[model samples]
Target: MAKNSEKAVKKTTNKIVKSADNSGTKCLEDKNYKIENPLDEEYVNEVHVSDFMKALAYDPVKGVDTSNAEHISAWTDALPVRGTTSSTKNQKKPSKRKLREQEAAKPKGISHSLLQYPLIFMIGLIMFIELIAYISLRQIVRIWENVFSWRGKKRTLRNNLRASKTYKEWCESADALDNYMHKDEWKKTIPFAYYDYRLLQKVVKHLKMYRQGDTMEDATKLMDVLYVCLKQNFAGIENAKLYSNTYLGTKALIEEYVEEVTRSIEALASNKYISIEEKRLAFKLYSKNYGRTAFCLSGGAGFGYYHLGVIRALLDRGLLPSIITGTSAGSLMGAIVCSRTDEELDLILNPELSSRIRICQDNWPTKLYRLVTQGSLFDAEQWCREAMWFCKGSLTFKEAYERTGRIFNVSVIPYDPHSPPKLLNYITAPDCVVWSAVLASAAIPGILNPVVLMQKKRNSEHLIPYNYGHKFKDGSLSTDIPTLALNTQFNVNYTIVSQVNPHVHVFFYANQGSPGRPVTHLEGRGWRGGFLASTIEQMLKLDLAKWLKVLRSLKLLPTVNDQDWSSVWLQKFDGNVTILPKSDLSDWLHTIADPDADRLKKLMGSGQIRTWPKISMISNRMRIESCIEKVRRLLRTSPKSNRVGRFNSYSDAEIEKLSQHLEQHDTTNNYANNSDAGSGDELVFLSRRRVSMPDGSFQHLQDKDSIKEQNRRRKFMAQFLDSPKEGNNSTQSSVLFDSHSDDSDSHSPPPSSPEDYTHN
Candidate 1:
């Protein structure tokens, strides 16, 4: 058994030796010998056991069989054993030292491994760089698409804005953008920022379409968005001007949007909280567009004609100042004539004919002019009437005439150096005095009737009348006049009226000293006869009240009081009171009364009873009668020595001397009593001395203490009067005592009265 065991051990040893050699050869090939195979369990176990024994024995041994133990163990355990083949003679076994030397001879740096795969590393790096570039480009494209896509969806966006939810969302989104993004960023990110601004505008517009109640809040928010966007994106006027042209179409759209916005602003402007800046902005926009919009709808000619009527009414009511800067009366007349029809045009166009008749008869001159000139027609006549009504005929006929004359003079007639004298005269002749009287009469109805009645009944007529009989005779005086005729007529009339007539002649009767035959003596047959009659009648009927009201409303009336005409006289006549008589107090009274009978009556009845009448007529007969009564009263009051005897025949010099004395005395007294005198302290002092007041006492009492005491007493009296009385008994007692005291005072004059003194 021992011998058999020995053989087995020998065989196992040989196998183990062979396996070890094989393992060593594999290790030499791979270089990582520490990586063991799991399948070699017996070789691993044998190597481990050998390592353990060596460790236990503390042997510092080399070449221990730590490897191939699992293989060795497996071979020992296996039952079958194959017969070994004989080794080839040429295969020499390498010694362990030789193996170590061979392994050390192999190249061993990381560079060698890297060098093996150069192409793979390069390819991977290139791919990474390409990925980063593609990502950046993709993001840029996405942002671009988002910005430009807004334009295509603008319509859809607008339609969707009708929905309350969509509107709110839009506003919120816009607000968010405004808050988060810088203005520069918005300008860059939003393609055509102004175009995007239109979106908010659209939202506001649709919201506005809904009635006041439903969409007001939404509309307000949308408007705020628009304003903020505009303020942020386009702040300066230069930017606005540049953008206005660059994006003209967009600007036009904005203009339309502004029109709608203006209405909304106007509606809300009355709210106390709305800022004045907003209101001013709205008004600026409105004014900028108003003329253009009005022109577009009404036409330039129509606007001119409308303005003409306005001018005419303004002149009639005396609402306009004497000197108008921007607009001319000729422009106004041209505007009106331009609106006339061919037939109406022909009447004014006839060189031989007069314009007065045409003006009086033509109801649609202003309207026709507007139609002809502007190629547009509105209710121009109605507008004129309304404007006139508002102006209250503050425009006088004389003013209208002057304005009309100015229009003709400046605009109508061409200047000619070599023109015939007759032609010049014809062109220059403005029956202005005649036309003014006629126009004034026509413009104001209150002043028209009395003049007409006087012309028919009275012998004297002061104004020139138009031949209405001849004017309406042809029955061709309709509105179908040619535009050229009207234009030419306007030019010719203006030229003629503006010229200075060199051949003006004044004829005097042989009996120059005699009073001219009461104006009634010359009423026979020519142009003067009819003109005077119609003119006087027209003058009488001018109701200035309506015109005055209009002037008042327009704030054009002069600040002069009718009762205190002294200031006017003082300024105009250089302090001479003689001009007061020539001032035509009757005409002034007529002017005040014709338009305002009620006002005149109230003023006349206000204070003293005797001097002025509540209502007065402008008839020559009424004036003469009033003057006669005044003269009779003066005669009755005068001393017998100063009276003129009916039988006394006096020379011209004596009569003139008497008249001069009376005139001087009357003038001096009037000047002294003049209420319009300056109220300066110097004047007041002079006036007090003239009135014979005690100068020393008055001056002594004029101290601050006295003035203060006087004021306090006045205030106390006012308070006492204002306070309610206790009852009827207390009121009766107060009244009875006051009456009794007044009667007693009247019965006995004060001893120191100035009136009771006799001159020594």
Candidate 2:
């Protein structure tokens, strides 16, 4: 009986284990597991197993999985596991309200379908735009070309001509040019004639170089065609020259054309393709040179008035600079003196004159506010008006030079930082206006605005000016003194440099070899507006100081402690006469637009008094040198006669006699006063002195012994120059043309004066 009972119990345990395994719960998976907890409602006591088995077997509910009910209490308040089959079947159904709450609580993100359509639409739109653009590409390009039609046409024509490597190809360029210029739109512009003139220049260049390496026969063949073109274009050339000075566009075009023509003519002459007479005629008509003395003035704001006194002293001594070059305030002063007589200069220099005209109108406090807001301190119209009035109306560079018989040069820096300073003279920029140039040069970067260069319209009695987009400003930034420009560009024999830049040490002969010391005490004094003025002043001083250091390092300027001071160094070594104020003055007080009349007078007086002795010495030397120069020039030009003995060189006595004649002539009527109007006649009269002989050559020699002594002293100084000291930047080759250097008249005389015309 015991064995049977044990068998039944084992059967019951096996059934329960099978039921738990089918329910698929991990905790009840062990067959030998027994519940030990009496507190857990899901736990069964071992003594109640028989009763529990009876209750499970005889349950009222059919098909109910009792195994799922085993852990009912634990799952009563919790969510059923999702993957279990028994839990899914027996899980309680949640209320509709609870299910809806759970569905609403889920997070909803942006839909991929919602974004897809718009992305596709954007892609399709972009593709459509690309397609339309591709179809209309040529039309769009044509519209753009029309907007810049003239420039495009010019570039095309130039390219067509430049692409031609041979004479045959160039003929086609001529045809192309004719077609291009004949268009009605181009013809009405009137400036198109200038373009045609340029094309003709290209043709001439081509003709000159055509087959030159092999033979001149081919080049000569083109002369008939060339003459025909010249005749056809002669009217155009005349029109171009007449209107060339009218506008900056035409001026720039003509300048380039002239350069091209010059190169072509030079090439033809060098290759013997043209005769000497033809070349001479071409140059006389087109290119001219005036080798004369040049005065180069440095920029100084109010200190520029000091130049007036220097001019007065020079004129008093009968010395006149034939060429004037200046920058900034110097340009203003130079323009004032250009076409005016001594009396006119005196009137302009008078302190009683309106300060607005003499000095620029400067309301610094107001200008500073404008400077920060509008990128400009003040309108330059008043300055322009003053310049125009001083210069006697706006005149072309050529007009100023022709009217005054003095070459006027104004320097200006372009808007481009890399470009070198431009020197606008009669030769370089003949059509540029005098007043405009002065205005452009005087435009200080931070204090005043830059100016757009303008051009005069032809036959416009109203004087309407047109701008060609060229902008310029203060020249002092690049070339402060402009002395080197005088030497290189105009080939002036003598240069007088008047410097007023306060930062640069002048080392006057009166300084007695004392070391230069900075005036640090004047640091913040005399600031005109505020921090702006002081800052700009300090910056200018610092920049100038740095430049001085550079010059010293390069040995261009000597050290203060050097045994042999560079007093008159430029004059001795570089053939430049440098003048400076002996006493350094306050910068802002002098540089400002409206300075104290007393200070201005004092400055002018100082200039006149201190430079008098130097001017007296220089004038004497110049008179002698001028006599020699005129004699040499006359000898080369005057007809050789048996009656006239050829002089290889003049003796001291002959030079003395010539100098005495000049001095006497100067005394009879101040040459400075009369030379401006009739310079040609005066030169001719001076040249005639070659035939006249002094009554007492011996007496003249005795009188000129002092001059001979001066020459000896110059030679002694020249000896020192030959042996450059250590740390000196000078080299023998670097030395410029000296006073004693031989000068030949290679250039033809001016054509303006009939008296100057001579047969070569």
Candidate 3:
């Protein structure tokens, strides 16, 4: 019985072990293992055999009997439950109330179909429609505004042009336009507006030609149609101002007018008589729009005054100054003001006296009776008569006479039935004649003789007053004479007038030198003065047989052989050398050669070159000179020696000097020192130099010059007898000699040089 019992206990122990192992494995695999107290009533129903075995295995009380079947079963029944309770709870079915509650918790009426569509497409479509509408509206507004503005501008321009009396003067303008337009070469030389002017002229000519063959009414209709078409295609007077000063437009108009007037004047002067009516009409047109013409010529404002003065002078002298009436008045005024005499001016104005001149009311058939009245005696008969009626009581004419006499320099006399003194009308001054002649000569293509016209006007005093007035039926005076005469002299001579010459004037200022400096002042004067002087000199040498060669030598012009003339002006020098070119020399000479040479000398004498840092200047000059010399030398050497290596292999003295110069000039130090025997030795030396030596150990050589001298001596010695003999000296012999020398050199002290010691 004892053996069987022991065996049973062993068998139970084996079974418990197996069950525990299985339960532990299962727990690990299932990942839901849980421990429960064996005494807990809640865990009793779910207890398993595997749970009991696991509890027995975990609690190892040595005497506990695990072999009894009933005890084991009881223990199993009391084993802690893990998954049994969970499984039983999980197996319970949902109640009807719980199902209803879960159903109520879910969201209702949510749809995702439309949400799946791309938002980008919807947004893009909406934006595209909005953009299309916006653009359409913008375009409509632009078109409306453009049309309205264009019409308004056109109307305003037409009114201004109609008011201008200069329209008649432009009758011959088409001819001038034709001349410019017909030439194909002119299309290349002239601008688009110039060509357009030619086209317009052609169209007008064609219409006129057609009119000559048609009835007046038919011609008029055709002209109207043509004019309308032309106006539509080409900008009218309204747009003239906008394009007048721009590029070719205004210039072409002025040029055409000038050409036409010049041609007409030439024809008239050549005895090709233009009708008096035509002359009168032209003058009226020109005079009415004189202001605009003057504005065009003078650029504007102050210039216009100058130009008008010139035009007035020209008109007084019987010259066709109308051609340049608008464009060049200001320039002409400047010329007159700058150079005309008072007497000359008076002659051109042709101020004159008049007698028996009558005044008529603008709209009355009845004339007001008045006697020769008081006022300035110099007043014209017309003025005298007007003043007589206007005066209240016995008005003194002395003041009026005096003012008129002072202004016009002519005396007025009463109208006489018998023995009428020769009546003077217009006032012509000498300056006015000169101004007119200049303007006419510049504007018209002819030889103008103002002297003859003045003489004729002076001689014709009896037939008509100097002002060319005759009594009319209404007793009012009327001037039938052309105020200005057109000279018959036609010449092709033209002169250019401009304030600035681009070629000779350096417009850029950045490169100009400092004030008071020679180079700076030379640059400041611009290239004009130098170019002028050189040009004059070249002109003088025109007779030379080798003019081209001479010019090349002078460097006055570029060479046909492709040689760069600019090189002559370029300064050639190294960092140490300063070589001022001949051009600069010429400029300097010219500067000092001014008529006020003494003043220039004084100015130069007031300062000295040494006023600044002398050493720096000297060093810089030296560096430049040295560099120049080195370059020249290098050039002189073989081309093969032009390599950087060849140049770098300079002597120590040269390199040292270069380094000193570079340092003085504030250049970077990049040169290698000859004393650096090798890179390793140099590095070692550098390291040694960086570290501080122990105090009082040894005195370092402080004098660099002395050290250099010592090094020179050592180099000299090593270069002499210390060198190895030619090959064939045995290695043993060499070693023996070295050993001997080492023993001797170690024992012997260094030989003393003359510079080693110095006496106080």
Scored by lDDT, the top model is 2
lDDT of 1: 0.23
lDDT tens digits, residue span 100-213, model 3 = 755464334424223223333454455456445434543454364345423554434433422322212111231232233332122123233212444334333444344344
RMSD of each: 59.6, 48.0, 60.1
Count backbone overlaps in model 2: 1
Q: After superposition, which runs of candidate 1 have C-alpha atoms over 4 Å from their true positions?
A: 1-259, 276-760
Clashes found in each candidate (C-alpha, N, C closer than 3 A): 69, 1, 61
Q: Show model 2 residue runs off by greater than 4 Å.
A: 1-292, 346-348, 354-358, 462-467, 506-575, 583-587, 628-760
Number of the top candidate by TM-score?
2
> Candidate 2's residue-wise lDDT over 350-453, tens digit each?
33333434444566787787677645676555455556665666677767766655678888876544456678877667666677788788877665666644
Per-prediction TM-score, please? 0.16, 0.40, 0.16
- Report the C-alpha lDDT of model 1 over 338-448, residue by residue, as the tens digit: 223223322222111111112223245654664555332332222223222211222222233333221221111111111111110112333322212222112211111
